[model samples]
Target chain A: MELQKKIEILSAAAKYDVSCSSSGSSRKNKPGGVGNGHLSGICHSWSEDGRCISLLKILLTNDCIYNCAYCVNRSTNDIPRTALTPDEVADLTINFYRRNYIEGLFLSSAVYKTPDYTMELILGVIKKLREEYRFNGYIHVKAIPGADMKLISAAGAYADRMSVNIELPSSQGLRLLAPQKNKESIIKPMGLIRSGIQAKREERKLFRGAGSFVPAGQSTQLIVGATPDHDLNILKLSEGLYHRFNLKRVYYSAYVPVTTGPNLPAIVKPPLLREHRLYQADWLLRFYGFKADELLNDAHSDFDTELDPKSDWALRNLHLFPVEINRVDYSLLLRIPGVGVRSAQKIVAARRIGPLSYDNLKKMGIVLKRARYFITCQGKYYGEKSMNEHIVRYGLISGKPEIQDSTPQWEQISIFPLLPQLPPPEVRLATLTGEL
Target chain B: MIYLYDGSFEGLLTAIFEAYYRKENPEKILRNKALQQTLFEEYIHIPTDEIKADKVYDSIRSKISHQALQHAYYTYLSDFEDAGTWIYRYLQLGWKMGHKVDYHLADDRVLTVHNTSRKVFGESHLLLGLVRFKKLSSDLFYAPIEPAHNIVSLIAPHFSSRLADQNWIIHDVKRNMAALYNKVEWVITELDANPNLTVDEEEQAYQGLWKQYFESIAIRSRVNPDLQKRHMPRRYWKYLTEKQML
Candidate 1:
């Protein structure tokens, strides 16, 4: 088949695996080489689905031996099948790197013939790119499940990062949707890659010339909203992966239903917002020092669609509100609804000069609308209403209209001894305080 | 008094140097091309002096911090209308407060300089990926970009190290300059708006496959053009090979 047609088919099959980051690897170009890794990866473009196109994400082939119900390339599905030769893959990667169209290659494949055979094809393409073409850019390849350990290790020597998709959160979901695939097959390779990365690190510490193995580490993807798995379960599983396997990232793909089966859930659209919320919660877990159980529990298995995970946590833990901005610890400042990591850091830095006022916080680009409800500046409250949970929640939900013009609509004249009585004071007070 | 100088980074630094030694506070510091003379104001044309510029540069590095010097340089590259005046004001404060001037986030002068520097650095970082090179008929890879900031010189070192074996030219079409890399070194020189160039026969085939891959990789169910535009803005679409269809 023609190269364009083959790429269209294979890239479409590979789009479901959404681990697009090309970061954490810092390889320099050889004297006569063609490419180098950007320490913090650069995104080349954004696809129409709003995902960053960091790498040339494509599969070696779409010919699958296992029929996963949620996948587009299931064995029962009628689709054109083709594979790229190692020569073609290398040629494409070199030309694309020269054109500056991608950071590197993200090579994945279906179980063509067998796991070991598919992995060998992948290893061949990467080996050709790294050794023959002298490509030093990022290469994120998949560690084919149930593939031979030696073959996986050999592939790791050439790949900067590797992944084995968990696919479903639970083993029951795996058995129900993908009968041939098991959870053990997925986790075994993750364990192998983790040890491989660890062993390489120890070796490099002793010998400066020791070659790196998977310097960017490993990542995995879980198909969200496919099986009847709760967000809590997914978060717990991800926490375990991060702690046990030392994974670099856990990507949550909002299960885009491509194939219908008895096991898969009938969904019209991908759960994008849910996936976004999971990412927000994931960020809190990774950087904000929040635990999975802290964000979700058995009582609340799903996130509040109306608010973000951080804001939801703040509203539930309202006894901690109105924390003194001048005296609060840095960790407590991070727990505030609107204070992100950058804003929290800025607050800590700016406060070292002097005690900050609300105006100073505003100048530092903190989102005052949500933060004002939970913070006090210099022993003075600037929130619109009192610290009642219902009132605060209502204020958060129905954001206050920004006062663009500083001029008051109603003139306050000193000549009049009484208060300005042109409007209904009770109704205005009720609306502002969320009490009638 | 208004201080006017040739529109170069060195000229801006020379103006700062002259202001310090002369003990006269200028009302506005501007580039020669951006001057708008008022009826009552006295204008002083400060010639570009490399020696004075280097002195101020070294003082900024030694007295203040290397990071502060970078901020000053990046702020100059921003080419904002008030970038010169803001840099002057920022340095005036930096001289008094040392490196702590950058931490004064509430101060408008420091904030403006920091924000402008961030913008300049951000654009250069983005161009590291957005630059699309086409293999010429002569085997020289050429790319044309019209960036919002003067960033051709900033992004050249990156490509020089990455594509060390290949000769390439990154043309800043808006600024009418190019970074010419000859596999060993790179130099920024003036180039015409349009250069006579031809792509190789196989370049179109590779671009066609790239465009196909770009389209195929987007999930049809979750296509959000607004988010795509937010990340890769519409202004940058003209140079992007995959965005040509849109």
Candidate 2:
């Protein structure tokens, strides 16, 4: 087959995995090497779905031994299968890196022939890219499930980051759809990688210039909406993975149905909005000191699609509102709806100069429209006098306050047309129903 | 009065030096080509003086933090209308407040300089990702960029460090200058002569493969061109290998 045809098939098969970032490593180029890696990943382009295309994400082959229901490249799909030789993979990566087409390579593969065989092919490509081509760019390779730990470790010496897809959130879901794979096959490699990385770090501290093992660390993808997994289940599992494996990132791929199946949920569209909400909640868990139970619990299994997780959290806990902009601690400042990590830090720095006002907060990148209801400037509230949950929710989602506006006659007539705007019932219903 | 200088970083510094030495708050500072004749305001020609420019540069380096100096340099690269006046105001504050001037975000002049510098940095950062190099038959990697900001100098350090082993040229076609890097060092040179540049015969095949990979990677179920445009703006699509028509 032609190289173009192979790339088309392999990349299409690999796209569903959805771990596109080529970041977390700052590997500098050697004196004779051709490329370097930056700490902040550089996205080469944006795919049509608005996803960042940072790496040359492709598979060694699309031919697989197991049939995972949600995957497009399952054995029973009868798709045109192809594989790239180790030389072709290395050639493409070096040429593309020189042309500045991509930051690095994100190489993955199916269980072609056998797990070890597939891993060896991947290892060959990376080894050639590093050793032969002298390419020092970021490389993120997948550690195939059930593959030999020795081969995985060999691959890790060359790759900056590695991943083993936790295909389903739960083993029960994995059993029904992907019978050949089990949770142990996936998590065991992750555990090995964590320990390998730990050992490497210790060795590096003692012996200068020791080779790094998976220098960017490891990440994993969990397919969302394939089974009836709750957001709480996903978040808790992610929190556990972050703590246990010291994982860099937990990627969530919204399940896009590819084939008809009795076991899988027949989702017409990928739950992108739900996926987006999960990412927002996941950010809170990772960055903002928020626990999984605080964001969602057994009672609330899913996120409120109508509002962002932070805003929803604030609305649910209304007693926490009216945090004084001057006196609010950094953690509470972060919890405020409009303030981001940067802005919260800015507020902390700027308030040290003097007590900040509403204008100053807005200037410092705080979203006053959302934060006004939750915070005050010098013990004075700019939001409504009678702040109720329903009113706050309405203001948060609809961008219109429930209270009637009394515009003075002098300010009524402007160049623009003045019309009485009312909230459409469907928007109101969508907000109330907590669905977008 | 309007002060006009050669369109160079040193020239802008010289103009700032003159502004300080003469103690005349000029109504506008512009490049020679950008100067407009007004019936009311007078025009003064400022010659580029490296000695005077370096004096200002040294004072700035000593007085303000390196971070603030970078902000001023990026703001100069922004080439926004009234950017010169904004920088002048920003430096006036910087001279007084020293390093603490960056935290004075509430000051409108400081804010404008900060925001415009951010725009310049943002574009330079985006070009770091969006640049697509096509291999020339001479074995020199060539990339053409037309960024909104004068970011060729800003992005040169990044490419030089990354592609240190290969000779490469980043041509800012809009600004009519090219950063020519020869492995060890680089210099920005005027690049009007195209010289009938041609890609390697196999370059087309690899570009075709890249375009195909780009198309196939996008999920059909979630096609949102608007979001893609937000990240990789449509203005930059002309030079992108993946965005070109087959």
Candidate 3:
């Protein structure tokens, strides 16, 4: 096959994975190095399709031995499959980097023969770039499940960020659809990477002057709607990983069905809106001083589809707000609807110099349209003074989805299962009517 | 009053000092300096008076915190329309308040000056991300930008430390000036205009590969032009290689 044709295939196969930022690594340029990771400011390259394009995102190979039902590269799917030599990937990366096309590489793969073989190809590609090409750019390597730890560690030495996706949230989902893979095969590598990243970080701190390392840290992806895991479960799992493993990011990709398999949930629709809401909830947890349980508790294990996580949380706890603008701390202000990170910071900064009023907040960049409903200016509420959570929720999600679409088939799947237990269908069935 | 001088920052400070020294109100001062362009335009040929500029700087330094003066200076260096005089006016207002000015956005002049400082910082941030480097023959590096606000003063230190080893030139074509770095010294130069450098064959090939990679990474399942435009505005599209209208 022509090299360009091969590139097209591999690149297409890699698009499902996302790179949310351009702050590729914390790695700085050394004596003779050519590239350095950007500090402070993150520059992300996004495609017209709204996906991040920082990584020279591609797969090592799409040819797989196992038949994972949800994957397009499943064994039964007669799709054209090919693998690239490590040199080819290195060449593309260096060439692209020189052109200022991308900041780094995000390389993933399906098991071509075995997980180890696939990982070896990926490791070889990165090694070639670091050694033969002398390319000191960011490399986000995907650790294949069941790959040997020794090999995974070798891959780590060359990569700036590594991810071993917990492909399906529940292990039982993995058993039925992806029979060849199990929970341990995925989770073990993640645990190893967390330890490895921590060890390297500690080593660098002691060294004081280590120039290059995985400065950007590690991240993983969760395919929403594929398994019936509730939003609470997802957020709780994310919280556990964040606190325990110290992950950099967790990407939530709405599942897109590309193959037909009996074991896979027959999802003919994609839940794009729900995926967007989940991301919003994830943002609240990460930046808004919100815990996963705070957003999703026993009363609500699933997110309210009608309202955003913050608004829902606010409505549930109405007693906290109508906060006096000049006095509210930055975190409390951030929890208010429509206030962004930038706005929150601006409020804190501006208030330090003066007693801020409602008018002043507008001038400082508060989105009063959303926030007015939740907040007050010196105890004067512009929003409806009603205290009901349902009223607030109905007022919000009642509006159309922001990035609206007749969501594609893949986005709307859902489920739950313990390691070997399938996800319950009732959780995601309100909109789906028990597709199971 | 034609506030002309050696064209140094100190000279500008001297000009501002003269504007107040001659007891001329700002409007009257400008009208007195009007010249060949219009009959109403006056001319006050201010000389290179170092003493006058020093006294003005000394007064500003003593009255406010050094950080405030530095922001005023950065605002002055921004060279935006009426930016220097506004900073001059605002600082005077700040000094007049004695202590109340520190805790008030009550003054419109204060708000305007603060806005200018933030505007310059904002541009510098965009350029921090937007500046693209092209390696030239003999390892000379170059980048071109047409920023909405003058942010060169703010971002020069970042470029110096980030690209510490390379001798590079960043040309802000819109403003008709450039910052060039030698082995250790960074200096600014004014040009009548720039020679729009042509893309070399190697760069073109690299761009082709970049475009491919950029196009490939986006998943078609969620193609939202509105969202893409929100993150990256259409105004910046012409300069970005991937977002160029195909």
Candidate 4:
């Protein structure tokens, strides 16, 4: 087949994977090499689906042996199959890199012939790209499930990052949809890559710049909404992956139905919002000092779609809030609804000069709309005295107060006295009291 | 008093030098083309002086840090109104507080300079990803970009380091300057090359493959043009090969 036709089929086959970041590795170009990798990755473009096009994300072939129901390239699906030679793949990467079209290559393949065979072909491309072409750019390749450990290790030395798609959150779901694949096949490679990265770090410590193994580290993707696994299950698995495998990122792909089967859910569209909420929760776990259990429990198995995970958590744990901005610890400041990592750091640095007021907090880049409810500037509070759960949730989700009929008569009567630029009486009332 | 200088980074530094020597903070610092002279207003044309500029640059480098100088330079790249005056305000603070002024985010002038510099840096970062090259008949790759800030220099180092094996030119059409990289080193030159250069025959095939892959990869059920435009704005769409079809 022609190269254009092949790329069309293969890239389409690979799009659902959605791990597009080409970051975390800092490999400088050799004297003879073509490209280099930056610590903070470069995104080449945003695809029509709003996902990043960081790398030349394509599969080696789309000829599958396993029929994963959620996947586009199922063995039973009637789709055209094509494969790219290792030479063709390497040439494409170099050409694309030279043209400044991509950061690097993200190569995956179906279980073509066998797991070991597919992995070898992928390894061949990376080996040729690194050794022959002298390509030093970031390369993220998939460690084929059930592939030989030695092949994965060889692939790891050449590629900057590796991944093994969990596909489904639960093992039972994997068995129901993809009988040829099992949990052990997926996990064993992750463990191997983890150990290899750990071992490489140790080696580098003793001998500086001893060739880094998977320096960008490994990441995995889970197909959400495919199986009946709860959000808690996914978060728990992600938390485990982060701690156990030392994964850089755990991608949640909203399950887009490509093949219909008995086991798959009859859905019209992918659960994108659900996937978005999961990412927000994942950020909390990674950066905001949040535990998985703290965000979700048996009663609330999923995140609130209306409000963000951080805001939801804040509304539930209101006692922790109304923390004094001037006196509160940096760790506690992060718990406020609108205070992100950057803003939290800014608040810490700015407060060093003097005690901060509500005006100062706004200038420091805090999102006052949401944060006002959670924090007090010096001795003054600008939030409502009656912090009812429903009212707070309603206020936060709506993000604005109703000036029409439903607003309280007492609040309405007071609004006539205030100027247009000034906030409502509720805001002024908190300012007047100097505490809520 | 208003001072007008040639629109070069060194000229801006020279203006700063003159402002300091005279002990006068000009109400406005305008580029030569941007000057608006009135009957009563004092307008002085500041010539570009490398020695004087370097002296001011050295003090900034010594008293503050190179990072602070970079912030001022990057802010100058932005097309924000009164960005020159803002840089002067920021430098006044920087000279007093030294390197610690960067951490003083509460100060409005410090924050404005920081934010504008951040925006310029952000655009340069985006251009690193958004730049698209088409192979010419001579095997030299050519890319045309129109960025909000004069960020061609900021993003040029990235492409030069990555595409060291290939000869390429990134033309900032808005500024009428190009960064030409010739396999070993790069130089910023006046853009004399034609905008409508022909693509190589082989390049057409790869462009076709890229466009095809671009379309095929988007999930049909989850198409959101607004989000795509948000990340890759409409301003940049004309140069993007994949975006051309839509």
Candidate with best DockQ: 1
DockQ, every prediction: 0.72, 0.67, 0.31, 0.60
Q: Taking the tens digit of each residue's C-alpha lDDT, what string does model 4 give over B169-225?
A: 999888789999998899999985467687899887777777887888888889988
Q: lDDT of all predictions, in order shown?
A: 0.90, 0.89, 0.71, 0.88
Q: What is the TM-score of chain B alone in each candidate?
A: 0.97, 0.95, 0.80, 0.95
Model 3 Cα shift for residue A259 (angstroms): 3.1
Error of 1 at A124 (Å): 1.2
Find the 10 residues in a row with the least total lDDT in model 4 chain A: A402-411
Worst-scoring 10-residue span by lDDT in model 2 chain A: A403-412
Error of 1 at B47 (Å): 0.6
Candidate 3, B88: how far from true, in Å?
Answer: 2.6
Write out the backbone clash pairs for model 4: none
TM-score leader: 1
TM-score on alpha carbons, each prediction: 0.94, 0.93, 0.81, 0.93
DockQ of candidate model 2: 0.67
lDDT of 2 by residue, B31-147 (tens): 788555889988888999999989888888899888877888899889876777788788888999888888787778778888998899899989999999999888899999889
Which whole-number lDDT from 0 to 100 does residue A142 have in model 3?
Answer: 86
* lDDT (tens digit, per residue) of candidate 1 on A137-239: 9999999999999999999999999999998999999889888999888989999999999999999999988998999999999889999999999999999
Tell me which of candidates 1 and 4 scores higher on TM-score.
1
Cα lDDT, model 4, residue A118: 92
DockQ of 1: 0.72
Poorest stretch of ten by lDDT in candidate 3 chain A: A397-406
